[model samples]
Target: MRLRNATIAAASAVALVLAVPTSANAATGDFLYKVGPGIPAGLADPASGECINLFGATEANPAFAPENFTSSTATVFLDFDCDGDVFYVMNPGKRLGDRLKLRSVVFS
Candidate 1:
């Protein structure tokens, strides 16, 4: 039947040009930082081939700096001044104030 309808329209035009969405599958952007005891700020400054990724962080070390209350460690530092900073490391026995509560995640 006309070469099977021209081989199914050339395999549906190569599956519609491989499903079109290119740019390496495009869609990359994310930023979020939170802290309760105060100390969490960094975002807004990245354009020049774009680069920034902290990606993970979670803190809730009441006051365990050197007490070694089991485990605790968090980090997210980028740019220093260009914008991006969230560092928390207290699990053993490090006491100061506020009680520390942080949540960070960044990517661009």
Candidate 2:
């Protein structure tokens, strides 16, 4: 009986460890951009290796003047869902002009 109880406890501990959620692999800083003539907005500590569509992006009003302050490089796209041709590649601590508009982005 004692051996069985010890084994059960060990199995429960292993299961608990496996059930624990892991932290996301996110960039350590913000990614700033502008939409139309509005003030600057950005994502704080955005997740890495995922496509992030701009909140208010469209053909008439696209996101522009991107500034990457994260630890990872940022790849911006002209189409939604990070599809279409690559608009530009912004490295960490880099900024771009308004001429570079985008609809989605991903951090690597």
Candidate 3:
């Protein structure tokens, strides 16, 4: 019947509209970087996830402090050219590489 065909066509249109996928903020276990013993690292935006690389860049202008033997403690920084990887300053002069430890990473 004409009415039956029309009803079926309407239902199909509605189903097609509902079937279209929409973007959603979902948690997936697919993308992750395991650093340290058992660490979970991932991006807030999973769609733009990719490999993160860190490169150590020599300081163009290193410390200009005069060389002297004094019993003084100070913090030193190990400069790095972060290609895409995150950096955390857990301690002074700490550089990340194979099996390096990390304290914490905060993203705002």
TM-scores, one per candidate = 0.25, 0.77, 0.27
* Pairs in clash, predicted candidate 1: 42-84, 65-92, 65-93, 65-94, 66-92, 66-93, 66-94, 67-92, 67-93, 68-92
The residue ranges of model 3 lying beyond 4 angstroms of the native Cα positions read 25-41, 44-108
Which portions of model 1 show Cα errors greater than 4 Å?
A: 17-19, 22-30, 34-100, 103-108
TM-score of candidate 2 on Cα atoms, chains taken together: 0.77
True-structure RMSD, every candidate = 11.3, 2.6, 16.0
Where does the lowest 10-residue lDDT sum fall in candidate 1? 62-71
Clashing pairs in 2: none
| TM-score, predicted candidate 1 vs. hidden true structure | 0.25
Local accuracy by lDDT, each model: 0.35, 0.91, 0.32
Error of 2 at 72 (Å): 0.6
lDDT (Cα) of model 2: 0.91
